[model samples]
Target: MKGLVIGGGVAGLRAALDIANAGFDIYLVERDYSIGGRSAQITKSYPDLTNIKDVLKPLMEEVYNHERITLLTNSEVLGLEGEAGNFKVKIEKKPRYVPDGESCEKCIEVCPVEIPNEFNERLDKRKAIFVPFSYAIPDGCVIDETNCLHFKDGSCSRCKEVCDGINFDQKAETIEIDVGSVVVATGFDPFDPNLRPELAYDKYDGVITSLELERILDEDGPTGGKIIINGKEPKSVVFAHCIGSRDKKVENPYCSRICCMYTAKEAYMLREKLPNAEISACYIDMRAFGKGCEEFYEEVQKKQVLYRRGVAAEVYSNGVNLVLRAEDTLLSEPYESAADMIVLAVGVEPKEGSSELAENLGIKMDEYGFFVEKNMYDPVETEKEGIFLAGCCQGPKDITDSILQGGAAAAKAIGLMGRHSN
Candidate 1:
């Protein structure tokens, strides 16, 4: 029996690997031009601050090369029918106009159109014909139809002229596959800090979100991992925690499990990169709940990173620094900290179209829009039989938990198909 994994993030990749290794045919569908998902955007994982790409790239290569797995990047699930052990899935495969061979610099040099790179949180621009990242799977250029000159007015075909690989006529294709079970690992969207105007995320150039900081810290990111604000290295960096999570103002009352840990990790990274810079982590509560998390927090504390118990009230840009206003709960007093930069510790939210996808799949979502599990005792199982969820698509979780759930979902899918003997 075959299995359909919706998403190509860590959880989906893990599930696909497990099922494919068990000798079952697996169809992994990803909505982006490449897989890897948000995890790929992360520079490092928490607790150990391990290089995320070092750990993930090999798994991605395995999935891409696995014989039992049919990896479909730039694809989406159009429709699904039937039940366990015999489900027909219709997928819409979008095109990446660049040809099959490795993407080269020739096409990029000729492409005149430039647009903000979404992968880099729009911190930088990229050519219309560009690879999503240096380590992008399929390792090819994808045309941004929305921004391509040829698509706009048929004005420029410079990329096509320079590179024989360009195919402007590439069209979307639909494919049907029969699978025994479905694993929804669609993942989560970073809480948009723009929603909280008080944070001044977009209003000020010095203010950025945690995810944006992740990209900025990445060696391959827009700034090549330099912690620069307005063309200058930040002398002081302030982290504002819980911008989305545990905030009744935004209707997201649940704790986004990773924010506290990731914020700490970011603080540690900042300390390492800017040894003499002042750094403070303003938080409501220190939730170092995971293994080695508390120790990591302690390490950051030992680095002289300040941990302040408070909720940031507002942030305004000064001529030279961003003034952060907040109340220290422990001190029972209000104070303002001036910083060269501010990073909002934004929370994770359900991915866009999650509610609609849940409806389409005949599943349920929690009030917060996360896919509801069968029960608290069995979190991976959805109310719908033969359907499972892994990663933030189900709830806010760390990468380790997401991978564990992926494996659990794979086991459930295998049992549902009665393939234990295989």
Candidate 2:
């Protein structure tokens, strides 16, 4: 039996690995130049401050080297035909322009065009020919056609001059594959804080999102792990939680489960980096439900991280620093605080094309647009036979739950394929 897994994040990686280790052929398709997805962007994880790349890079290597698993990066499933135990999937593979087995640095060093690095949340710039991140698996460079000088006007060929790996003539390829089962593991997108103008996300220089802070804390990120804003270390930092989740104005009423814990984790990280700096996290509710989560929250509190029960009403510049006005629900009073940096703990939502993808897969979506599972008890199974789900595509969840669901989805796929053969 053969299986196909869509989306190459942690969830899809685990699902594909499980099926391959069981001696079945599996194809893992990713819509990016490389895998890793949002998890790779995180500097450290909550509950335990394990380095994000330490865990992700090793898994990525295993998947890339696995013989039974076919890694299809820069690809997406265009359409699906047939039913359970017999399926034909059409895929569109985008061109990366970098040749296989060529040194990526050779092309990158010669490329002169610079643009905002999306991987760093636009905190820095990168050459037109570059890898998504330092630890990108398959260890190669990908050309950005949109910004590459050669593609824009056919004027510059410096990258190609130094590297024989450049393939300007590469075109998008269409592929067809046969599989017995399919798993959809496309992850969620971080909520855009600009939707909440009260936070002053893009309007202020010091205002940034929690995801952007993750990159700042990362050693390979924009600032090389320095927590600085406007060329100096911040003396005061304020974290505001539930920027998108549980907010009716944006129409996202569901709780983004990871934000609370991640904000606490960021607070602790700040305490370590800036021991004397004042740190506060404004939150509506402290949902530390995961195992060891409450203990970690207490640890941050001991480090002098103030936990305020409130929501920030507005943020604005005050010449010297940014002023955050919020209501202290516990004290039943208004409070105004000053901070050099304000971090918005934005929530997660379904990826952009989720609705269209659900329709193509012949599945249903909830009111908020997350794929609906076959039944609440069967969280991994989709409404259609032989179709399964894992990770945030089903709903907002943490890394632990996503990995567990990935394994469960793989089990279901294997069992169904076995029964079909019988």
Candidate 3:
């Protein structure tokens, strides 16, 4: 059977590889120029402590090489029609401007756009055209439309003027395909830290997200694994938990399963690299539920890392310092801590397009836009037969649970194919 998966994240990539291994033709679509979704932006995973791209590289290689799989990068599923056994998939693919499969390094060197990379949350800057990261799935440069000179009044095409491999005629194309099964695992987005004004996230130059901090601590990231913030090494760093997550009134009420583990891991990593700096994780009940999760958290606690059970009520600046005001529930008293930098373990919300895709396909999603299952026992199988939900698209889950869901999605997809007696 021919199947189409409309996401290139961990879960979608995992499903594509497994189902393709089962002898079915699979078409994998990714909106980004690369296949490894947000996970690609991270340096490592927690609890087990493994590099994210190291895991993605092998899976991506499989997706790239499988004879039964057709990979489409820099594309989005524009529309869906028909259902169940047969359907038409409409896709919109934007151009990379660079010639397909051509090695183009000079373009990046010559391009004039020098803005912070969105993928790494502004930790670093790359030219207008750049691989999302050094180890990006395709490992090639991409043309960012927003900053491209072609869109900015056509004044400079220095990249094109330098690159001998570009094609001026490369235009976006919308194509339609026929498929028997569909998988939607578009994943989730982090809550905007700026929305919570009391936190004064954007107002201050120091506060950042768990994702952004991950990049900063990464050896390959902008800071080269340094605990520096705003041009200086911070004497103290504080991680505030449940910033945009686990709070219904602010951003989301979801647990964002990966937060606790990441927070603990961040604390540990900070201690490993900055033994002299003060570190504390301000959280409301650390939810460490994965295998060896509790032990890892204990390890961070034993490192003289302060585990203050509390939610920071507000953050404001004081004479070149950021002040956190909150109640330390364990002490049952209000307290304030001055920190050089703040890391917000902002919660993960469903990726921006999850709902629009669900509504367009007539698939069921919860009030929050994650794929809603018909029953909890069958987590992968959604109300739409032959279509499965996996990863954070269903709810807050760590990488372990997401990988398990990936395998389960493959099993569910295979079972549906078997029912057709093809």
In terms of lDDT, the best-performing candidate is 2
Error of 3 at 116 (Å): 2.5
- Winner by lDDT between candidate 3 and candidate 2: 2
Give, for candidate 1, the lowest lDDT window spanning 10 residues.
413-422
Where model 3 places Cα greater than 4 Å from the true spot, the runs are none
Cα error, candidate 1, residue 96 (Å): 1.0
Per-residue lDDT tens digits of candidate 3, residues 1-422?
Answer: 68888788888988888888887888998888888887877777887678887888888877887899898888888878887767888988888877545556888888888998877788778788777766665666678887888777787787777877776568899999987778777888888988789998878879888898888888888888877888898888888998888888864777787888898988888888888989988889889888899998998899988988899889988887998888999999999889999899888888887877887677887877788976988888888777788888888777667778887888777767666646
Q: Give the per-residue lDDT of model 2 (tens digit) for 151-252.
A: 899999998899876889999999999999999999999999999987899888799999999999989989999999988999999999999999988999
lDDT of 2: 0.91
Model 2: lDDT of residue 78: 88
Estimate the TM-score of every prediction.
0.98, 0.98, 0.96
lDDT of 1 by residue, 1-422 (tens): 78999999999999999989988889999998888988999999999989999999998999999999998988888777887777888898988888755476788988888888999989999999899998888788888888999999999999888888778898999988888899999999999887889888878888988988999999999999998888999999999999999988898999999999999999999898999999997999999999999999999899999989998899986676799999999999998999988999989999998877887678899999999999989889988888899999999999999999999999888788775234
Please list all clashing residue pairs in model 2, or write none if there are none. none
- Decreasing lDDT order of the candidates: 2, 1, 3
Which candidate, 2 or 3, would have the higher TM-score against the true structure?
A: 2
